[model samples]
Target: MQATSRNFKDNAHRALEDANLQKAMGFVRTGFIDKRKAAADALPEFEALRDAARDIKNHTLANLDRYLERYEAKATETGAQVHWCTTAEDARETILEICRSVGARTATKGKSMIAEEIGLNDFLERNGITPIETDLGEYIIQLRKEPPSHIIAPAVHVTQDQVEADFRSHHKALPADRSLAEPQQLVAEAREMLRQKYLDADVGITGANFLVAETGTSVIVTNEGNGDLTQILPKIHIVIASIEKVIPTLEDLGVILRVLARSATGQEMSAYTTLSTGPKRPDDPDGPEQYHVVILDNGRSAMLGTEYQEMLRCIRCGACMNHCPVYHAVGGHAYGWVYVGPMGAVLTPSLIGVDQAGHLPNASTFCGRCESVCPMRIPLPKMMRHWREREFERHLNPPAWRWGLKAWAFLARRPRLYQALTGLQVRLMGLAGRRRGRFASLPLAGGWTEHRDFPAPQGRTFQQLWAERKRAA
Candidate 1:
């Protein structure tokens, strides 16, 4: 909700030291990675589908104004109100006003990152309205009064034992002796608790995975089926999404869907992929009476024509983060914001300011795993480099870093000087650490050496090796 991205180093340090979090992170290291690999490997057309998804997103963004207007007209024709919000405050106020119109005392919510981005839950509580998260992962975090650690799996950072404890602590009406040793037991308990809340809710709010401009439909894919209950049981249904979610046609949605589940959770499809076009028709058995769509810009429009535009293609499948080494080490909470990992590293700085979130872009190892696995082929590593450049240009980095870069640049301009200094330094280090083949500590490299030994220089620099090879040839 709030930007503590500036304190990412401290957050990451704490996360690394946390025993519970480390145990929870084991699920991340073992679960998503293998499942995704297997799923992707099984589908021969997976890569092709990724390319098509990327093209569709790019086309829609290029003609966003036209598609947005068409989507509004179509949705309005179905008796649904579409509200355009240019800022987070505007989006939050608009949602509150809609809740007020319905006299909503309590609202049921499906998982929505945009809501998190806008701080909707706290805002609703401050206005005397209660918001209940129905999605199992979302529900768990809600009870703990914490933000989601992962996009799709909000409670992934929480262990099963911790969840059992949370359920016992929060659901006091339930039997304190009830066994929650298994995940199924926990789910049943949560389901029983939320079943009544769904019926009592005056409003149901959800986030759209994809907004179909051709049909004016809002789509959500979930394994738990809680999203279905959240939207249908309430009298009023509200959809909150960002502008980049809009796609041109159902065919395009189909192409994206083919890859979404596999990339996210290794499923051919989620248990439920629900699409809502509008409110209930006269003949309809059960559905919401009032339908509203709140589309928030929240600084996304500014990214349209820039190099960072590739990031808008993200489907929130979270493949990048799932495969990211940094995320696996420290977990998402260390990012200190709604989005996390490679996608967050690029997108957070864009939504917030580079000055506040500058450290995020620098967190990467430049291993290129994120870009390699991205469903939309977003150049994550390159974008992070761009942000780093922006930070340096703006002087957002500390003075020591600036001076270090300047010193490197000065030597880099003269090839001979750069090679001479590096050669001398490597030889000295090589002799010093020849006994152990590594250094326990090194000057100006405490961050690396403090964690683990720095590998000693084996021989001459790359330039020297290249020169010798060229001479021999």
Candidate 2:
């Protein structure tokens, strides 16, 4: 949860060298992409749904203040305490105060990026409260004492063998010969381990995927039902979410839900889509005694009406990262923050200072796959470009980068000179590399050439080819 985004290049290099991580990332490449495409193809109205989802979020963001007020009022009416936090520190302190007030010794947690963003677990531990992650992926990384590598699939960077090892190390009470070779066996083991924790927990903490303004409901979608137990069994349930998660109605929630599952996990719906309106009523058989919603603004309120405002439309479905080549190559930890992939590239800089996270926006290959697959149709590439422009304008970039851009700009302004220089260089490079049709090493492009050979220019530049074709025609 600390910002090592400043060391992204080093992180990426280390990730590339991590053989286990590389093997684990193979799951990402094969797991999400094809499934998402098939799911989208199966639905005749998928594209239309995407547009509707986008409009719904845009409308909600435009009237966010009204919806937030309504949500607070409605939630309070339903006997849920609504706490507004302007900063991460405020949110953390508020949650801790709630825990302390309840005399909580331990808290069970569902997967919450908002919690991760605020460094909640460590804060709670330091304050004498143990926070237990019950989500399977979250549980895996929690035992490893590492940050999540993927938003939806937190332990995606870890291989099965590594997981088996981690389980063997952490679950000492379990038999040493227990079969963890199968994933289901691992799940069963974790389930057995966590069942007791749920009953023992005094407080349950979760993040809301959507906060319904009309009903004061906090919605979470998960493949496993851990979120249900995490929020239900404890004496108290606390929802931590950002302000932008509030939407106008259950109707809007339904629309977004259709796209959210399909985009995130390629399912029509998750195995469990749980919605909690408030605390237990007298008639309810099993539910928390107290319900609390902690809405954190952090830096989101400042993003409104700005070029970055569209980013609030993100559903955290993680479709962008699933399709991003850079994310595929290095995985999420290289991103050095809670959020990862294309969405993270744009959002991290806005939440944390651009100065601290400036490298994230530049991590992209600008393939535009992220935008294409985005259910909300967020223009990720455009936002990243905006970040890059801001970085250059603020002189946050190194002097070498600035000088290189200036040199390119000077040459670009003179078309003939630019073309001539490029043409001559291309010819010389082509002649030099004619033997192998590639360059194993290049003078200034060591980064590109170190891992793989650079393809030599076959002939003249595109402009020259275009001119020749026009004259011939």
Candidate 3:
């Protein structure tokens, strides 16, 4: 919805202080990270698949225009209307127009970040059309009236107790004394509640994980079967996706699929991997009557040839966020955007501009966990560094930060001076903290020292030790 990347520091601070958030974040470490690692380890060709996936995306992006035309021709031939939108506003209005024309009262939605990016729900509501989120995670956040905290696991920030409360609060018709202590119970309750919404929906909307040009198919992979129900039961089905999602062939999709689920949720394949080519054929048993594909570019076309183009390779796996230390500490809402963590840090700036999202790139510690786990092998750290450089160059950073960088740059250019200054500072700090072997508080490092002590430099500077080792060798 609204861009709050500018308030990331404040958001992060609030998140860190939240006990429920801290408890929920435990799942990221204990569940996702370990499961993903095990899943990757089980696959003999996982790394190779990642490389292939990256190459497939690169090829698709390079010939994106050609593939888009091919996709349109094939989809149109298959009785699907393909709408190309250059902006979020255009995409929102187009979906609304389709709904209005059909006299739609409500639409069922699968988990779609593209819809969030375009503010589709609010737009539809304001236009007198109800948008119902059917994906479990999406439905949870919808009930809470909050944006998704994570891309794949939208309600990951929500705990079991909180969810039980939300269900009790929202499902007023349901018995209050029912036992909702378990996750299965919660799922069953939500499933029963949403099943009616699916049946009553006039249109179904979903986001494509991959758009196949050769077959003119839109694909969605989900552990829950909500996406399948969302698209099939409604009279009309609409696939909303960004331009970067288009791939040239089914073979390429096959390669990417080998890595997407493993990297995202540690499954060989999600329980339901649904592909819709077009509206129902005459012989089809059950399907939508109308099929529409809305491809929104937003600002992705501008990133095609730039250094940031590597970011387009992202599969929205959520691996980077799962492995991210910063995300683990404060959770996803701290990013203040639809996308979160390393991918969001780079992509948000591109979509929403670096000025509003300047703090996102700076939020990282650049430990490179994100790049290490990325299925597409996107160099998230490098892209974030580029954003930081852009921020500095554009003078978008605060004066204190600009001055600090300038001061560091001045000394960095001179080898001897840099070494001498650092050596002196290290010696002074080393002596000062020799007794404790750490500093609980430091002049300009309050942020670091606030949580834990800054370890004291042991003795000589690292350069001195390196020089001695080099000479000995």
Highest lDDT against the true fold, candidate = 2
The positional error of residue 137 in candidate 1, measured at the CA in angstroms, is 1.3
Q: Which residue segments of model 1 deviate by more than 4 Å?
A: 465-473
Q: Is candidate 1 or candidate 2 better by lDDT?
A: 2
Tens digits of per-residue lDDT, candidate 2, 167-215, equal 9998898779878889889889999999999999999999999999999
**RMSD per prediction, one decimal?**
1.4, 1.1, 1.1
Q: Per-residue CA lDDT of candidate 3, range 366-412, in tens?
A: 99999999999999999999999999889998899888999999999
lDDT of each: 0.94, 0.95, 0.93
Residue 239 Cα positional deviation in candidate 3, in Å, after optimal superposition: 0.5
Q: Is candidate 1 or candidate 2 better by TM-score?
A: 2
Error of 3 at 407 (Å): 0.8
In candidate 3 the C-alpha lDDT for residue 306 amounts to 99
CA-RMSD of model 2: 1.1
Q: Write the per-residue lDDT of candidate 1 for residues 196-262, one digit (tens) a residue.
A: 9999999999999988999999899999888999999999999999999999999998999999999
